[model samples]
Target chain A: MIVGVMGPEGSYSEKAAKLWMQKYSMSGSELRYFADIEDAFLATVQGKSDISIIPIENSIEGSVGVTLDLLLENEAKIVGEIVVRIEHCLLSKGGPEKVRVILSHPQGLAQCRHFLKKHFPDAELRSTGSTSHAARLAGEFEEMAAIASPEAAECYGLKVLLSNIQDKKENYTRFIVLKAGKKTLTEPETGSEKCSSSACKTSLIVYLEKDRPGALYEILGTFAKRKINLTKIESRPSKKELGDYYFYIDFEGHDSDALVKDALKDIKAKTDTLKILGSYPAFKTFRSVNIDKGY
Target chain B: MIVGVMGPEGSYSEKAAKLWMQKYSMSGSELRYFADIEDAFLATVQGKSDISIIPIENSIEGSVGVTLDLLLENEAKIVGEIVVRIEHCLLSKGGPEKVRVILSHPQGLAQCRHFLKKHFPDAELRSTGSTSHAARLAGEFEEMAAIASPEAAECYGLKVLLSNIQDKKENYTRFIVLKAGKKTLTEPETGSEKCSSSACKTSLIVYLEKDRPGALYEILGTFAKRKINLTKIESRPSKKELGDYYFYIDFEGHDSDALVKDALKDIKAKTDTLKILGSYPAFKTFRSVNIDKGY
Candidate 1:
């Protein structure tokens, strides 16, 4: 199996890919790194990779708009999800006092804003393509530092100047694994023996029939009536005009379930466009395992 | 009156401030520029500025998460809103061929990605604090170009090498004017003459009583039952836990309306926390005005 991810080799995305591999027991799978999220998705669609792992949302920063946008436009299905705790480390070749420049991805820099402001107030902060790219650059310069993962420091042969430098200790990023093939969805099964063995999540995008008053209320009513718990809901521009939006919603339950099918049917009747992005098992949070511990 | 905005002078916020000044006939009001969005909001809260105009959402990019986060935490109320068309221009001191580096705010650069890739693929792309700041730096060097508003070119004494270079031509950003004082909301008036003179929008954040199934359904039911039109609905992590979220919803009709008042009363009964962010007149779309034309 081949897994695609955004990278400079040792990015958080690469870490996520590793975590996902361990969770699914897909050891010995070849990992391919793409330039960006879109390219990773494209690789899966073009059959260059079996699966593409992409970040969907961050605990502090919220959703990744580009990934969401690509999901809406692409021909891939979300098959699984994994949440990775983001622990940023300040890496440098020299001591903290000698560091005059700080670098990381824009998000990495933003995550450690308070730490940087208090310690390296005079450091020139710069954004690179990835944290690992910053780590590689920091390794070459004695006066430079990078905000990245501890794994990145090991990868780039840089010493950890500071560990867990992010503002929030519980920061996490949820990544969805996407595959090219679509699952076969049937008319929801109605039975006392509910297909609830695995906690399932159905993600879909809905466009209202018209920009009318109470349109969304009526659409959301379908899921509300079915008592389906919504995990997430967000509005994105329809790209047609101002005020017009397409709602991306994630609700609990599989598409094969009775209530979800009924809800989606009712929702489709009211919406001009209704695209079921995917159905996947909801992610369960677990304590971070030491990656350095050999499995 | 003094208006606070994100600085470097010739930014889209300043342009929106000007439009707002015209809309309210508040010309001759002093415009104060702040370093960031949070600072602009702080200025309003501190009485340094009477009102602060900040971008809330872009048609293409979705909501500004930081602005939304600030609104949730701050004491200010949204008084009004204005939508400005985002027309990016490539500005430089010399011709396009002489440009070796491009600079702009991250969003500005992302918006003009296609134009940059097609024309100046080899140019180094750098992110700055503001587009006008980039324009200022671009003006100082013959080999530097900035993606900014045409107004920035005029402000920084640079030439517009290309106009309307954004990936999406219909791009528009909605800016909300926030004031320090909160409005006292009352029950919707029971009168034959409804206060439907202007299209109004009510923004609020709701935290459910518990993370229960159909908790959101019941919340939406209040609005659905009243036939209230929801313009937008989004969930942001409560920063407490991964699954815990606060729903930020925007719906039509002022808080003064009878149905809206009834809905809120019911919603408050069911919710643990209900905050009425503010009610403001909905922005109307209009053709882009020539900022260069004399007022």
Candidate 2:
């Protein structure tokens, strides 16, 4: 099996991929890295990689717009999810006094704003393509430091200058695993299942038939009447015009389930467009090291 | 009157402030620039500025998480809104061939990714606090170019090397004007109006009384039954734990309106916490320069 993620390597996406593998007791999977989230998804669709793990949202930053947009545009099916706590660390080759420049992915740098403001007030902050790439740069430059995962520090032979540097301690990111396939409206066959799990979730993108008052409320009513729990709801611009949006919703049931199917049917009747992104198993807790801990 | 905004004088926030001033036909308002959005909001809360124009959401990028988070934490009230189209330009002191480094706010750089990849694939990309700040640095460095607004080129004495470099053409950002005040549930008195508008919108942060199934669906039922249109709905992590979230919602209608008031009453009765961000006039279209048009 091959897993695709945004790279160089040692990024949070990789960490989530590893956690996903461990949780499912899967081994011998090769990890492939791409330059961007869309590229990772594309790799899966093109059969270059079997699956792609991509960050969908973050606790502090909210949704990853690119991932959401790409999901809407691509044919990949979400097969699983994993939530990883983000712990940013300041990694460097030299001590704090020796560092004059800081490098990181933009989000990584923003997460450690307060720590950097107080300690590296004079350092020049630069954005890189990925945290691991920043780590590589930090390792190569004596006067440069990087804000990244501890795994990145170890991979690049860098020392942790500061740990748990993010402003919010409870920061977490939700990642979704995507496979290239058309999602079926029916549930998977239980007896001859290639991959199946209990506790399923169904994701959908619903567009209103018309721009009318209470349209969304009526749609939510479909699920509410059936006592279905919605895990997430977010509005994304349709890119056609202002005020036009495509609602992304995640609910707690597989499409094959009777209750879920009825609700989706009602929603389809009311909505102008309804696309089921996929139904996959809900995320369960898994054990992983504190990423903030220094190597 | 004084208006605070994130700036180096040519940011989209500054443009929105200018547009707001023009729409209200107000004059003699000093526009003050801050290094960050929070500082601009703080200026209003601390009485340093009468109002602050802050970007609430972008069509392509979605909500500005920091702005939403800060509004929830502070006592600022939304008073007005303005939408500005984002147009990115590649500005530099030297020609495109001489540019070795590109700088801009992370969003600006991301928006122009396609342009950069096609034209300057080898150039190093860096993130800055503001697009105008990137323009300033680009002006100072002969080998550096900035992906910024055309206004920044004029302000920083840089030449526009390329225009309309963003990947998307319909990119627009919505900015809200905030004041330091608590919103009253009652409708504003028309005769003794200190501030009032005809078409209004009320924004709120709603927290469920408990994590019950269909809790959100029930809440939407309140608005749905009232035939109220929800402009937006998003769930932000409550920072308490996983699955716990605070729903940020914007709906058409003033809190003073009878139907809106009744919906709020019902929502408050069922919610654990309900905070009214404020009621303000719905956004109206305004004429502004196309950002992609080169100087």
Candidate 3:
């Protein structure tokens, strides 16, 4: 199996891909690195790679807008998900005191905003394409430091000047595993499958038809009336107008469930556009398996 | 009047701040520059600056996540809004063929994504703190190109190689004017106020008490039954857990409106925390004023 991700072999997306392979009991998987996230997703969608893992949200920064945009405009369906704990470390060839320039991916720099402000207030911040790329640059420059993972520091032969430098303590990122064929996930034919209806969650993209007062309320009622709980509800611009938007929603329950199907049917009839991104097994359900076994 | 914004001047935020002042017919306003959005907002909230202008969303890139997070965490209230047409340009001191590196704010780079992919695929892309800052660097390096506004090119003394390079032609960004006062907007004492209930919009942030199935539906019902329309409804993670979220909603109606008051009363009772950002005359109302006179 081939897995494509935004990577130079040490990015968070690469780590998520490996975690996903372990959870699914899959092996002999090969990893392909791409500098751009869009390019990575495109490779998978075009069948250049069998699967793609992309980060969708971070605890501190909220939703990854570009990733959400790609999901809305693409044919990829999420087959699985993994939550990776993020711990940003400052890495450089020279000591921390010698750092005059700081290079990182924009998000990486933002995540470590407080730490950078307090310690290196005068350092010039330069943005790189990826955290791994930043580490590569840091390896060649003595006056430069990079905010990246420990793996990146190791890969580029840099020293970890400071670890766990992000602003928030409970920082985590959610990455989705996607396949190109389906618009929505359907029920499994076999009874031995782990992703049963109760353990899965559904994700959708919705756009309203007109400026009705209760249009959104009516849409929410379909899920509420059936006792379905929403996991997430985010809005993105439709690019057509200022106030207009495309709503992205993630909710509990799978397409195989009768109540979920009913809610989706009602939503499809009410909204102008309804795109089902996927129905995948919840990450918590998979994580608890090893925890329950005390491993 | 004094205005605080993310700037080195010639940045999009500075342009929006100026547009906001013009729309309000305000004079003698001086602009204060801050490297970070949070600091700009803090200066306003702390009364260091009379007002602060921050970009909230772009038509192509979606919500500015950091700004939304700040709005949720701070006590600042929205006093007005302005929409600025975004026109990105490729700037350099040298010719395009000699450009080996391109610098831009990530959003600037993203907005002009198609233009860059087709032309400068091999050029190294570097992220900067702001578009104007990118222009500053391009002025110093002959081999470097920058993606920024035309104003930035002029300010930094660089030649514009190409203009309107954004992926979409109708690219625009929305900026909100915020003040440090008011938890919720109340009716004005005099009838002379321009922001009457008819032409105003009230923005709110709501967090639910528990995971009830109909919690959000019930909250929306308050406005729907009152015939109030929602302009925008975006969700950001609460950062507490995976599925927990804080909903940001903007709807048409002023606080003085009886039906709007009714909805607010109900929403306050249904949710754990309800923060009213502000009630201000809609941007459309303000923009139409000069457009009607063909200016």
True contacts kept of each: 0.51, 0.57, 0.66
Model 3: per-residue Cα lDDT over B91-203, one tens digit each: 99999999998988778887777788789887877766678888988999899999989999999999999989998888888888888766545745221135766678889
lDDT of 3 by residue, A85-182 (tens): 88899999999889999988777887787798899877878767678888988899899999999999999999999899988877888888888865
- Model 3 complex DockQ against the native: 0.66
Could you give the TM-score of chain B for each candidate, in order?
0.88, 0.90, 0.92
Candidate by candidate, in order, the iRMS in Å equals: 2.1, 1.9, 1.6
lDDT of model number 3: 0.81
Instruction: Please provide TM-scores computed only on chain A for all of the candidate models, following their numbering.
Output: 0.87, 0.89, 0.93
* Highest DockQ against the true fold, candidate: 3
Q: Model 1, A62-175: lDDT tens per residue?
A: 777778887877777777777878889999999988998888866677667668767976676665656887898898889989999898899989999888888777788788
> Where does candidate 2 clash, by residue pair?
B87-B291
- lDDT of the candidates, in the order given: 0.77, 0.79, 0.81
**TM-score on alpha carbons, each prediction:** 0.89, 0.91, 0.94
Full ranking by TM-score: 3, 2, 1
lDDT of 2 at B61: 64
True-vs-predicted CA distance for residue A207, candidate 2, Å: 2.1
Candidate 2's DockQ is: 0.58
- Per-residue alpha-carbon lDDT of model 1 for B1-295, expressed as tens digits? 8999988789988988898787666777999998666677779989999899998887777777778877888787877778888888999999988999888876677667567767876676665666787888898899999898998999999999988888788888888888885555753322112335247888899986435777877788788777887878877767665667788888888888778888889998997688887777777422243343212
> What are the DockQ scores of the candidates, in order?
0.50, 0.58, 0.66
